[model samples]
Target: MSQTATILVIDDEPQIRKFLRISLSSQGYKVLEAATAGEGLSQAALNKPDLVVLDLGLPDMDGQQALAELREWSQVPVLVLSVRAGEADKVLALDGGANDYVTKPFGIQEFLARLRALLRQAPAGEAAPALVQVGQLRIDLALRRVSLGDAEVALTRKEYAVLAQLARHPGRVITQQQLLKDVWGPSHVDDSHYLRIVVAHLRQKLADEPAAPRYIVTEAGVGYRLMG
Candidate 1:
């Protein structure tokens, strides 16, 4: 998915744009930069990025105005970033069609996580199977249930979220950051210990051993992939 996920960074600050570009590039997302509101709008229309990281304080115009104008034609996901931490400002951005609001002084992990969340799955419309079969485990995405060889696996919400995400993409390698962000939220992406703990618990429930994994296989210093 990252091979071509272009993210537009709309901010007046060159440093912010550089920071985002570097961070996002490391995560394999293609980065596009715009320093002003008009440039952002023009870039959005011209490039049609997969996701947008927009700042509320643009030099030429307010970010909300750009967002509103954007809403008139596109439904692309926008993560509004601003120094304005006021609730009213957040509400205004959200109401104007922004998908999410992140205040300035945000953690890079969290910011990346929000972007991952926005681009996590395709617009949810395609019908998936009611039950997914992975080895002895059967996942019912609809009923919110998972059964392993006729024994229902009782899992916490976080556990289930992680498993379901991996199950949905059987052979794909989900990055540690992606899984962490998806399961534990953005702020927890860099907390590898937390992910390890959860994965350990999940493996225990699934009767899986890390050394000879039949279910979730650790990709060593990278991420995890459910054996297909």
Candidate 2:
């Protein structure tokens, strides 16, 4: 799969990026580079790479923050590579959104093995469809972009999270607990109010009305469903 896979490397060190580019390219994997967390995120959104190699220390923003933001709309496999070998740092990165973690000064063979393992877990065949359209609403899940007909819709991270979940399963009731756990994490599963507020905000931005809903329909104390 390395022959067709695309990997995005997000690290501030020019030497590190160059090394990874060479190593990955040697294995026939297409590589994309970004020098900062912000740039890395833009590259991830634009390229929709098969896997991401992230570094925890970044110049503009923490890599953990970048991981959290990327998780808002993408489930692409992420392997965090950082110099921080502390157990706490590893735990934080894994819990935040990383699929795997490698400390700096690691062996190239081991890194490549881990990379291959992550790629094997993704769906075979071609990459999953990145776009989902329902009526006038169009969602580019890979880019974390949403649009309603001709105009693009700007959504907060949480807003996009909820909408993306709902959009993935149109015409099906997504339980409130499920949405809470996914969008807000497990600790907030019982926090129905949080989910409600986000849904309301999502609806407002999508120009959907609760009384006469077109896109989202409330299920009367159960949950919400996206009407495609």
What are the lDDT figures for the candidates, one per model?
0.84, 0.88
Show pairs that collide, candidate 1: none
Q: lDDT of candidate 2 vs native? A: 0.88
Show model 1 residue runs off by greater than 4 Å.
Answer: 1-3, 121-228
What tens-digit string does per-residue lDDT give for candidate 2 at 87-107?
Answer: 999999999889999999999
Q: Which stretches of candidate 2 lie over 4 Å from their true place?
A: 123-161, 183-205, 219-222
Q: RMSD in Å for candidate 2, one decimal?
A: 3.4
TM-score of each: 0.53, 0.78
Native-referenced Cα lDDT, model 1:
0.84
lDDT of 1 by residue, 1-228 (tens): 454689999999999999988998988889999998888877876677888899998889899988876764456789999999999999999999999999999999998888888887536443334357878988765445889998999999888888877876777899999999977899988999988888999999999999999899999999998888
lDDT of 2 at 103: 95
TM-score: which candidate is best?
2
RMSD of each predicted structure: 15.2, 3.4
